[model samples]
Target: MPLGPPVPERAQRLLAQLERYGSREHGQLAVGRRLLAEHPDLPLDGFMISSSMCPEPGRPLHSLILRVGEHDTDGITAWARALATEPIIDGARHQLDTILDDIGIWASATISEADYDMDQAVFIPSGDDVSFTHRGLLVTEFGEDGDLLFSGHPPAREVLAATSAYYRDTCGQRLRAFDGRDLADSITRGWCRFVAYPTRTDWRIRSASQDTPGALPVTWMYAQEGDTQDLGDPVHCPACGRSSRGLDYDHVTGQRVHLCPSPVCRHQWPVDDAPDLEATEHRQDQRAALAAH
Candidate 1:
């Protein structure tokens, strides 16, 4: 007796064809590439193939699931139907049709617009370690306990490029790229450090203090009236007397201030109090001119 429902004759034939095709080296890759080439308009994220054999004596059933963007359901279905009739191999027109007969092909709309949002790329620092996430999906994580975890694949190249552009243009921050697990381990060990800009191509890395090079400066702050200070310039904390180059903004005493980068210092100074080097130099020149006169 077959387990569950008896496999239909067409399904059996399809399964047999799939098994035969999959036995060839790089067969699955070839199919995926063909699908991608045929449907250039389709936003194909990826795909999966699975086979199952159930019941006491049953023919193996194979399934091909295509992951795509949500709005392309009808388009994907139409393409699949066309693929069934299309001659994939040059001399064998019936081969592909026979294999597609009653084949378990499914389209899943898993990729969304938000998945490519550059703003969704964020780095969360926790104690001595940090984690990088895009659209709430963990890309890579460095644990304080010296544990490292990575999401199977890096973010898409376009997504990473968009994120890099966003940080550089919108956030007014510079980015450095780090690839592979070895550099990530170096970060945890303090041999090097990097900002959480998403890139898979570059392998360059650099080291700096907590708020020095390769750090994202906090640029979000509500400006009070008549406050024309350029927050992009580094400020020195009066209390700590340390430069606030990569430090974040803080609200203290009902005004925007530069939070000292030093964890031990924890000092804040009013934004207006930050020295204007240009203005000071201009004033000095005026005084010198008056004395010359």
Candidate 2:
């Protein structure tokens, strides 16, 4: 049986094609390029590294992979290192603290080396493997995959169980596990990241933390309210086509916050360079359409 959720048709077809490359003369080269072309939802906007060392040298490997969309990667790196050195319970709390609001999909796995090899061989373009260790708790980057954005593959059921044990040793608990065979599963489940209120009951994917509420919805919180802080020009929201003369512009953060007047499209976001909101929204629509299939 296929592991985890069913791989999307397009991804499954591409994966089959990628598998063929494993036997080609180049031997798994260009898999990442091909995958990115076929699936743009990858690099997952943002994610956190859930690291676990190999429990059994020969069996499948497991790790926690949380989809923390668009959070600063450097921040996560610093936090992961710091948590690794802290006491076990503290480390666990630290992980939750960093990602509780941003996290979308909480998936752990125990995937066969062969399966991971298949995904990595195609996804990782090239790089020397780097291992991260803190206080003897070992965590490593997923692979030499070309694009680090979507680096690791989800673990199989068995790999997840083994990984839970490893995570328990390293961080004090095992996350709810899923059996994801390829990157397609990751993309499918990742749709929740964009949703306002995500529900895990309908799918195999589960929340990483006990908190049932979804991540903070995207919004433009007012920074300053006085006339000095107000933007002079009538700015319009590209997403909703609403126009307003007064908007909050924070000099300290170097950000201009705008909230759409449209009730149906109460879109809020910061404007730094007069972002092409229409274009961005179009692209997101395209991605959602693709995922629906």
Candidate 3:
């Protein structure tokens, strides 16, 4: 059967995702074609693998069984790569896009979500006790219509909880550092703030972080701004009175509070995670500015 229009587009997106992160070996297009034949409607990319599960552990190249993206991107490839390395920046999106051009693809990034909203990047646990390959990031893309499209598995209780944790840690606590020369050093010696992905054993440390150290530590600093919520207030945004009923705090800071598509305000608040006097004032000024408009 001929591949449908969406099928090619979906493949493109998966490839782009993989390229952006520089994780895992590319998958065989033939395998992907066959897999697509099995589930023509499936929306997935990347593969999954682990170092411990590899015949050799900590050898770098031979440490992982890199499952799917050996030739193409799919869930499996996403899993393998995410589990393989530690992130260096706190709020930096993975540099996966760099590979897109090499793979005959282009990347387009959207603000997946407002800073204060719920967003996630998850690591699915591997079935194998020694597997280091099960991992992936789940991004929450909000629509102008006030709905959410969470990439990954179907929405459920566990998923929600896990997403919350991920949002808190990845975007909140942030991966502050990477160190040492290889995978083990990054994990044991604080080369990364996130260890939940690449389970230790499955990690194949081909080289040390020193061999190819990442950029600077990820930094996440928030202000006490906006309708600064009191320690006890649970019902409203203290800054502009944007309640939690149908709104969330915007985390993207072009240096101050910014109103997103959240209905309460068409305010020009700058997108950011800082919540302090300046952020609050910015929100207030944005609100006042919007009212004048």
Model 1 residue 127 lDDT? 33
Clashes of each: 0, 14, 59
- Kindly provide the TM-score of model 3 when superposed on the true structure, using C-alpha atoms: 0.18
Instruction: Give the distance in Å from residue 223's predicted Cα in candidate 1 to where it truly belongs.
Output: 54
Q: Which ten residues in a row have the lowest lDDT in candidate 3?
A: 217-226
Using lDDT as the measure, name the better of candidate 2 and candidate 3.
Answer: 2
For every model shown, what is its TM-score relative to the native structure? 0.21, 0.15, 0.18
Which runs of model 2 end up more than 4 angstroms from their true locations? Answer: 1-130, 134-137, 142-267, 277-284, 287-293
Full-model lDDT for every candidate: 0.40, 0.33, 0.31
lDDT of 1 by residue, 1-293 (tens): 12124444443433345445463242443454445445555545556665566612433255555555554544554555666543222111111222332334455332232343323323333333323444543332233332233222333443344344434454465333221112122221232333232321211123434455443322111111112223466578788788764322332123344567689987866557665455456556656798999
Writing each residue's lDDT as its tens digit, candidate 2 over 30-79 gives 32233234444433222223323544443222222333323233333443
Question: Alpha-carbon error at 100 in model 3, in Å?
Answer: 58
Q: Please give the lDDT score at residue 141 for candidate 2.
A: 26
How do the residues 1-293 of candidate 3 rate in per-residue lDDT, one tens digit apiece? Answer: 23344556666555444334434353323334444444545334343222223423323321112123222323332432433432222221222221111221111111222331221322222334221111343332222321122332332443334433443443342111111112122111112121222223222122124223331111111111112222232244445665432223343431443333346654544333445565456666767788999
Predicted candidate 2, C-alpha RMSD: 24.8
